[model samples]
Target: MPRFMGFVRMVEGGGMPPQALFDAMDKYIGEQAQAGHFLDGGGLFGTEDAVNFVVRKGETTRVDGPYAEAKEVVGGWALLQYDTLEEAIAGQQEFAELHAKYWPECEMVATLRQVSDEAPEAASA
Candidate 1:
């Protein structure tokens, strides 16, 4: 089984989703969880107090957010496991459709990436 991380990115400060969307998601997630597809996931609050640590050259510096340039931020995420790429993609599409059907007005991007336990080839030393 391959594990994937699914991120739901949306515009900043969209306030809250409609209760209908929440209700729909609850039903959807509950079913997936019960079937052992969904591992864990949650929605995030606004990034008013977000912190970032950057290392440039040999120095490290800290930065705080509500970043002016960040138009879209990760609003929600899920940890999922499936049998194949097709299965993962199909699940991702279904999750995205929930947002499309419930919140047609807001723009969102659902990103799905496989989780790698080892470092990439570029990181080999």
Candidate 2:
């Protein structure tokens, strides 16, 4: 089985009620966990308040900014382990549907990659 990272994106201020989002997320987590697709996940704040960085010439620089200047930004993400990309995609679609009730334009990103147990830690650039 390969492990994947799932990212959920939403345009800032989509006005999704907090309780509704929470309930949907909870239900989704329960469903995915029961299916052995969920490892862990969490929501995030605005990108303006997110931690980010840039690296150049072997030097690392911390920046207070989002990767892109789009109305939609990554609001949260999860670590998932799935047997195949198809399963991961299915999970992503499910999550998007859960968010669509309040966040009709919410987008989802399912980045599927085989987890490498021996992957080395990246040096601070």
Candidate 3:
């Protein structure tokens, strides 16, 4: 089985979604977990709380952000394991559809990427 990460990016300046939407998401997540498609997931704080470090020419510069002109910021993520990429995509599609149906006012984008098999230890060895 391959693992995938579903990145959820919310539109900037969008207000908090309704409680019913959260409830529906909770139920969907629970169902995915029960079906063994979902492994782990979590939401992140706003980008205002984030810090960025840039290393250039052996020097490091630290910067704070509401990161400039960003249209969307990653708001949440989910880890899913599936037999194929199509299955992983299908899972994300379902999530997107749920949002479309329940939280149409909340603009969002969901992207799916397969997890790489390479581990640090394996790469070093």
Best by lDDT: 1
Name the weakest run of 10 consecutive residues (lDDT summed) in model 3.
116-125
Off by over 4 Å in 3: 119-125
Which of candidates 2 and 3 reaches a greater TM-score?
Answer: 3
Higher TM-score: candidate 1 or 2? 1
Instruction: Give the lDDT ranking, best first.
Output: 1, 3, 2
Count the clashes in each prediction: 0, 0, 0
Q: Which stretches of candidate 2 lie over 4 Å from their true place?
A: 65-70, 105-125
Model 1 over residues 9-89: C-alpha lDDT tens digits? 999987678888999999999999998889999988778888889999989999998788998999889999998889899
lDDT of 1: 0.91
Which 10 consecutive residues of model 1 have the lowest summed lDDT? 116-125
Q: What is the TM-score of each candidate against the true structure?
A: 0.92, 0.70, 0.88
What is candidate 3's CA lDDT for residue 3?
94
Candidate 2 similarity to native, TM-score? 0.70
